[model samples]
Target: MFPLSLLFGFYFVQFSSAFFGTGGIFGHVLRYQKLCLCRCGVSGVTQFPDSFSNVRLLDGQSVSPHQFPWLASIKIDNRTIAGALISDKHVLTAASPLYGIPPNRVSVTLGLHDGCTRNPALSSSIETVILHSAYVSGYSYNDIALLRLRHVVPFSQFISPICMPDFRTLESDQVASTLSWKWAPNSVSCTPRVATLPILPVWTCLLNRNSDTITPNKGCLGPLGIKSIVCEDDVGAPVMSRQPYSSSFRLVGVVTTANCDHTSAPYYTKVAYHAAWIYEQIRDDCQCFSI
Candidate 1:
């Protein structure tokens, strides 16, 4: 059984290169094996454990400090957007809000809880912004982007990358969650809130809405009564799924359109559908783990 599993892993690595354009078969395999062994064997680890213990089904609640180490705050000029750390030097986020913004004006902060008091030590200047080639301004389709940090982040109890899952792990109607940051009433600091949601089918997402707008690469979540699990602040947040019997969480989607009123379901760019693109872009630092 062990031998079979090992053989399968090798085949998966070789097979993925054809789809992801990783180049040179032997080099790709060696690079992937090294990445899996050295760089990100510890991805998705957390300092604060979240069992989603006794979580209410109706409302999202505040999470404890450092509960989500991969959460990233992308400050673009005066406003901020949520993002998820996927590697030492890369962050995954939505492309809509950043459509017209210049990459030079954007910066990212990790280990962030309160938005008002940003620790200078935890911030990094963005070196480049790579938007999905197919993404268009004012359009929801292909709304994904990657930000390369000028300086690599050192992993610690307070900071880490969320694991990027294999396509096999993505399934419909799975129990998932998202972490969002919203400003306090005083507008002095931001609070981190978490909510549990269920992934819905594309057909279900189009039931009450225009079917023409729902794309195959998009996925839906929520309609949780009147109050919603996601809001405007969650637009660029990561929809994550906790691995069974594991403390780690895998990024499943990137929020694109969230309706706070719960009148319609929220939508996200399906990470599984764009797995090859993501892997292709992050090839240099990519790491794969069993889903």
Candidate 2:
């Protein structure tokens, strides 16, 4: 099995060169892989249990293993951060974790509800790290990123991808949430936390200092008061929302920047705005993923 990945690694190198010559989707692939390409199963519409039989959330961590299957963890620099499994081959997160860490040092672990406590069976190696083209050193608006796994994650009761939202379905003043694990003040263990916040108008997020960077592509999680909900290590937490009639939760934004003050809503990069860029990374056109 390892040899199979290595075999593709060779072809990936060749195809990547040809991809560079084309300079279209190839550029997106180039930006994502950062010279090293990896994979898991390419793509598929997966089935997940709408109702978890034995799952609960205490703070920001799930009580059972399969409670929140789409919630995954990115491990780098001996620190584990939150992320969401958007597909079998891709996990969505903020650009902060990958900023200074070496790509090879990162891995995404799925199917485990308690990310802070134990190692899970379903882990994928990092293949590529793609940050938004407009991302800068300190600015956080365009902070969304994709991590392509080196191997396919077998979908199971304990592992699945979250739903991707269509902009048309997200009406104004919709309720969205952040599902993550947090370490509280003076607490030894982290617990699963859930904080549902209203999707504020983009204009509201722009009223702050340096708010000119606010665009339709960003989301604000304030106006709901959540200082008691979010934790210091909860960055990259998925901003999720359930469709009106759907049981499964879809990913809407990522925890890019947040405030310890509930008075101030945190900032997240709206996933809908980058829908096109995201599709380009996971789509079959790249020839980077194999089932």
Candidate 3:
């Protein structure tokens, strides 16, 4: 295994240099140079489908009306940015898109079927946008930002929140599998034996470590050691997990970065990690509205 100190050193160098916007020099090195840096690998239970209807555009259709029930289009002074509804009062998105824009200049369009081709006049406007206190411009660390709508959206089968995973339920490899192996104390084993044991990695939901004491110019990347679902145009999308209580989904993660393209891995802000912060933001900024 590579030295942990070396791995951390490399990561810090890359992160710090990139933070300065040095023409993305560090990013280029990491992406193209094939640096064998040790990233925290989160092995766990999740399946990637062949296709997702939420992100894909329909064939022969410029806009997919009702493709995703809770999808929303965010507009700031006539310029549109991608966003999605994660809860009745919360809309999730990336911070970069709204960096310099004032709150009044931003408006969210809800209950929209076709945002790409529909006229702006056809959509309903949101009341307010509540940006995260630590949102930054260039770097996409704590890339998540929330929008608190003036009114609450009624819960419907088509429009419900996603479920979040429990952090307490997460177990490490040794604890998750109840198996043990023993070697003969006095015998030398020559033949190699490979055990075909399937081990699933534990996935823990986490939140911003310093959400309350955050600064406008500094967005925290992570607490470290978690799997992220980063995607492009995922800037303002909702990361949801299906729930068992009903056929509804629970809000788990928020779409944050476009750094991971179609060919690259995606990243998302873990919802379970920041549920308290999210609740606080919603309670403080939003008012319930009927559909």
lDDT of each: 0.73, 0.66, 0.42
lDDT tens digits by residue: candidate 1, 104-195: 89999898877656544388998889899999998899999999899877877678778776645654767677777752222323567777
lDDT of 3 at 121: 23
lDDT of 2 by residue, 77-129 (tens): 67777898877688899987678666799988776655456655577788888
Which structure is stronger by lDDT: 1 or 3?
1
lDDT winner: 1
- The true-versus-predicted C-alpha distance at residue 143 of model 1, in Å, is 0.5
User: Which parts of model 1 are misplaced by more than 4 Å?
Assistant: 1-59, 119-121, 183-189, 224-227, 286-291
Residue pairs of candidate 1 with colliding backbone atoms: none
How far residue 248's Cα lies from its native spot in candidate 3, in Å, is: 2.2
How well does candidate 2 score on lDDT at residue 164? 68
Q: Can you give the TM-score per candidate against the true fold?
A: 0.80, 0.72, 0.48
Highest TM-score against the true fold, candidate: 1
Candidate 3 lDDT, tens digit per residue, 1-291?
566766675566555554744335553444211122322111121332333223221111122333344555677785555555655666766677777776777777654543334433224445655566665567655666777666666644334333333543221231111000111222211211111111122232113232433323222222133332232433555544332333333444454542322322234455566655555555322121111
Give the least accurate 10-residue stretch of model 2, judged by summed lDDT: 34-43
